[model samples]
Target: MQVSSWRKAAITASFLTLAASTANAAAGPLDPTQGGAGGRIIRVTTLAKDGPGSLKEAVEAKGPRVVVFEVGGNIDLGRDVLTIAEPYLTIAGQTAPSPGITIIRGGIDLKGHDVILSHIRVMTGADGKPHFSDWEADAFSSVAAHHVLVEHCSFLWALDENMSASGPRFTGKTLAEWRANTSHDVVFRDNLAAEGLAFSSHPKGEHSKGSLIHDNATNITFYRNVFAHNVERSPLVKGGAQVLMVNNLIYDPGHRAVHYNLMNLEWTGHPYVTGEITAVGNVMRGGNSTDADLPFLTIGGDGDLKYYGQDNRAVDRFGKALPMFGRYGETKARILQQKAPLRSVTGIPVLPSGEVETSVLQTAGARPWDRAPDDIRVLFFVAEGRGEIIDDEHQVGNGYPKAAETRASFNPAAWNLDTMTPRSGRYPGDQTGPQEKLSPRDAAMRQGGV
Candidate 1:
């Protein structure tokens, strides 16, 4: 029996109502309550046009320190990776003059424990042409890190995964070392990860991804983030512990949506048992003509990868639920009701997936006070591949040439921007629905001045 889109909508509507009520009952900032608070404030006072202070030294400083920025601007790491190995650290870009700080041309590697990073922007910038060594770079990577919270950040134009939480990668590391490097208790919330990503380090450039969670990364949560303009892995979860992907907004994902897999020899080079993922209250929508007609779920390997889909929503241009897709003949009517084992991880918040678009639009990327008109312009330009018109004034990062680079022929900026214009208000992009209810920290910041 064929299912009508309207019937799917009705089921989704009921689920959304329930989820919304649950979210409404709970209200607070999703802060990393355990680390870096009440720590020593290490103020980064310089906008170092090129070297220390704002660039590398402060970011790489060791120990339980709160790294706060005094100035707001760009820091280009030039092919260098800023490795944060210190535990109990708080990198607060919100403390900058305008919370508009951006890290460009390089990536941030979190190899520490109990770290909290908020209101920061990490971009490879527009000039990251795909090289065979692209895999060496990523916007943000967590390696065996624990109790980390990455919130209200912007990650763009990554040659590899935009924001990834992976175990020890294969780089001549011993198997025991790889097993020892396990990431756990990480949370990525209210962030924007967008645009022009490469598949792997190789020149394929075919599979642009937003975020990837690889083997042994356990108990990770992605909540209320905007995964925009990338292809696959707007999280692809491989073998891991429990993963909760809740209330995320995927706008114009080019190839596919959330995928889960167990690892075999192809990628991990080892046989491994997979973990379970509960994808709830997420929304995926097509925003451009270039967006592909892709599956909502892709399962690979035979590693017991289980998925529990509840209250998720997908819409085409006309705002209808997408046709469902799963392996074999297990085709369901609505993609939202896919069945697998249902479980929960403690400390993971269950916000309504219905509010994902609104919540992300309100809080993702850099804080509103820090962004200038030029910053907004750059975001639009890079996402759409309109690199030719972008100049130094509009560029936020320090990558050379400062022009948008796209692997795809067709650009979608002109069309997507026309449909959605960001405005100065309580939300990020034009107030799409009821003013998003702000978290306590967000409300305090906005009331204090923006």
Candidate 2:
């Protein structure tokens, strides 16, 4: 059936609403007596012009509420809407929400203290050019604001039409500086961040920073987040702050995954001296156009960098290993200690077909095998090329005499090679010359010596 984009979107929203309602019902009715004044959930969908006040006003009316910005339809943060203030409130997105509330011509000033913002997209004006407003000094001029939570949101540049030639380039500087000093107790997780500039412009530049648990911000946990197609640098940890970065997929089309540096405390007027950064189980891939000289990750000055179970797919522009700081043992230990067992949060059933089976059986004396458990494995016999088992238990080896010999000796009958077959190999069950001669033990099995 052909479904229009709008219809598809509507269907998705309906499904989400139904799922949420069912979940709430399963949890039972909320007790008004619990958790101080029972957390309130406020929905914001009306346009600011249609209504007199901004979405912030709606949240304030609820009194210590959880304001969910239900962006069912398109809405804009016009020039007049300048600031938002709400204490102990959560600004969440609904129904394909894109940064529910955006600060356009005039930057947004966040005054609400200890605010939790999630699933909301934050972007600049639509103008193609940079609107160089002092975001730190003017836009977000909150004095007492702290403990901000930003998750599952997309932070990017404004549209081209909203930009002007005279405006400042949509460089990542303003935001980077803002995070360096202003925000505290900030957690950014499962969010995508991309710098607007090109690689040539700021080859070694740094972008946003904060309290990342598993990724960028300090005291923040970033798990299963994708950071890809980023220009310039990713997160630059300044000063001596500890950040836990794990299980994140960080790829830079232009630069490295992360850069750690010792803050020139004297020059930058910062108090901290070194950054203690730990990274684990992260997949770091580089862009094709990137210079071969750079490493997938880098650390500067006298800072610590530790990595464990990390996979670096792309070599940096330089031939040297990605610059990582810290002791390897300590980093691995931290990752092991912090690792949590996977749990089913949604109560989804596991499908039998979805699970993959991997097991290997080898003859008595064979070359030591080096293979990951997850990799596919195949059993090959030279006389048959490859054989098939009739059932889970290899009661029947249907191919050549070598196949019968293998099944008899290897008891289990099934063997996983954990190796990719060459394209030129003969078809399964067809006898062919061995690409590489097998070990004496393997040769005996092929000759039916088992």
Task: List clash counts for every candidate, in order.
Answer: 2, 39
Global lDDT of model 2: 0.33
Q: What lDDT, from 0 to 1, does candidate 1 have?
A: 0.58
| Model 1 TM-score on a 0 to 1 scale | 0.70
Positional deviation of 381 in candidate 1, in angstroms? 10
Residue range 1-450, candidate 1, lDDT tens digits = 332232233234443332221111112334333455555556665655344656356656666666655566666676667888878776766545433567777788888888877777776643544445444567888877877888768777676677988765443355445445677778887677876444434355454677888775666888878776676687887754567787787777665677766545544566454466787888877655224455566666555655687788887655767754544233221222325535553445556766556444544565533443333543454334333211111233433323221111112222111111112112122212223335588878977955
The candidate that achieves the highest TM-score relative to the unseen native structure: 1
In model 2, which range of ten residues has the least summed lDDT?
356-365
lDDT for position 313 in model 2: 39
Pairs clashing within candidate 1:
281-353, 387-404
TM-score of 2: 0.48
